[model samples]
Target: MNGQPQWQPISMLPVFTDMIDGMLESSLEQLQNMQAVKDKPHVLDDSILGRVIALYSEQLQNHGAFQEQFNRWKKTGLCATDLAEVERLIQQLAKLKTANETILGIAKSISHATIDKIMAMDDAELAVAFLSGKLKRPI
Candidate 1:
């Protein structure tokens, strides 16, 4: 067989599993943090807001990566072990999906509240609020 191995290469299922676990944990932490400030978005600091946006972006990227990895794994012949891992990953993904939705909802409510506050302000008030750091420019 020349120098090539006769068997197929090892599966990457474990690596994918670990990655998903970490993502799930991070997502859950984000969800908890968002819940704490859901009722009072104005209290959120710039760092927290930036982190939320970053988490959302990371989720999108991770989703695409997962899909690509799944497709490639399927092409290599899935066994029972692989199927089990895939199912677990799917369940974790579902939880992540729920968390992401809640996070977005909280973000939406915060945006609405901020907009209402801005709408009630006069031009002079708006300028003062902006200058005083009560209002932030859109990212």
Candidate 2:
């Protein structure tokens, strides 16, 4: 419902944070590998790219939602541990962004206009774009 609070229970915050951390870390590793092999004559794996896109999409959504909810939670007063967890998530998201930029640079396939459009897209739109084959391998 629109009026419902989107925040998760405090008890579950760590679990969600951990899941997100793992996903971001995995995606970064995959992206780094892709970068390492960019000079080779290997064919890009669509499945792996798709997985990275999916994970990145999910991470963006979760990060946005968590940040919004955390802002609201802050107004209600949060404990130090909660604050630290949110900060950690924020830092991880930054790493994800850097990794994404590096991979984008390696790809050199996406146009500036498409990059702008992708940057403006929400999670669902990103997923749809990927599914529609708007994003492909050339990186």
Candidate 3:
């Protein structure tokens, strides 16, 4: 089998763009939340939330560049070099896959501790913390 990836069709470009757009938006939203809270311990704890957020932010910036390339590809259709770049981006996202899973696993591990806290939290408080990103993963 060839080690390189096959070229993607022009039709798939929009789909890829949409997927990346969603991810970028989510990352940006999370970053905003993280920034709003001044006292939250985001990076110091063993919690991987900070790392995950940073990863997402990096991905978002990458996606912005990719978006420009995508728009160009849309106008011109996919070329060999464009396909290669897309494949590279896919690989980068694949690496990010592991980090995303780690974040989920960490959250799951701490969910039990958070359950009581979450349960005790009022809707308004929870919403504020969640929106502002003040909510740290409960250890």
Candidate 4:
């Protein structure tokens, strides 16, 4: 199989799980941090906000790389054990992708909302409602 992709044991990479978990964790922390300052009408820190955005961008690139690797390996064929592991990893990756998209969507929605709009929300309303489908943006 000349010119074909090689099938290395990629699922064994130490950073595989950590990278995914870290991205998810970072998103949650950022969202929580946003909530903490939800009432502040004029506080937008580019440096702090950029950190989570950068992390999400990196996670997305990593996910794409892993997907490309998995697709290439599909042609090479894994052993029974490796196949099972890869299948499990693929499932986990799918979940992670969904989570990444969800977080990105939240960030995107919040980006459009002005500080005055966010500050107008009552404490009973979730800070994330400005971004989530649960609450509609007022006209």
lDDT of each: 0.68, 0.60, 0.52, 0.58
Q: Residue-wise lDDT of candidate 3 within 1-139, one digit each (tens)?
A: 1233344456676667566546645644544544433233333333455455456545534544554554455466567876776665565455444444444444444432344555667899887777775575433
| Cα RMSD for candidates in order | 8.8, 11.0, 11.8, 8.5
Query: Candidates sorted by lDDT, descending order?
Result: 1, 2, 4, 3
Query: After superposing candidate 2, which stretches have Cα over 4 Å from the reference?
Result: 1-5, 104-139
lDDT tens digits, residue span 1-139, model 1: 2233233233666776888888789878988888877666666655566677767756755664565556556667678888777777877877877787778777655763354566778999988877986666654
> Alpha-carbon error at 59 in model 4, in Å?
1.4
Mind giving the per-residue lDDT tens digits that candidate 4 earns over 14-41? 4655655565566666666666544442
Q: Rank the candidates by TM-score, best first.
A: 1, 2, 4, 3
Which candidate tops lDDT? 1
Q: Predicted candidate 1: what Cα RMSD to the true structure?
A: 8.8
The top-ranked prediction according to TM-score is 1
lDDT of 2 by residue, 1-139 (tens): 1344467666676776886687677767867776665643135444455555565554555555656765665565568988787677767767766676666555444331234455667889777866886654335
**Which candidate, 1 or 4, has the higher lDDT?**
1
- Residue 110, model 3: lDDT of 42
The list of candidate 4 runs beyond 4 A from truth reads 1-44, 112-139
Candidate 1 Cα outliers beyond 4 Å, as residue runs: 1-10, 111-139
RMSD of 2: 11.0
| Model with the higher TM-score, candidate 1 or 4 | 1
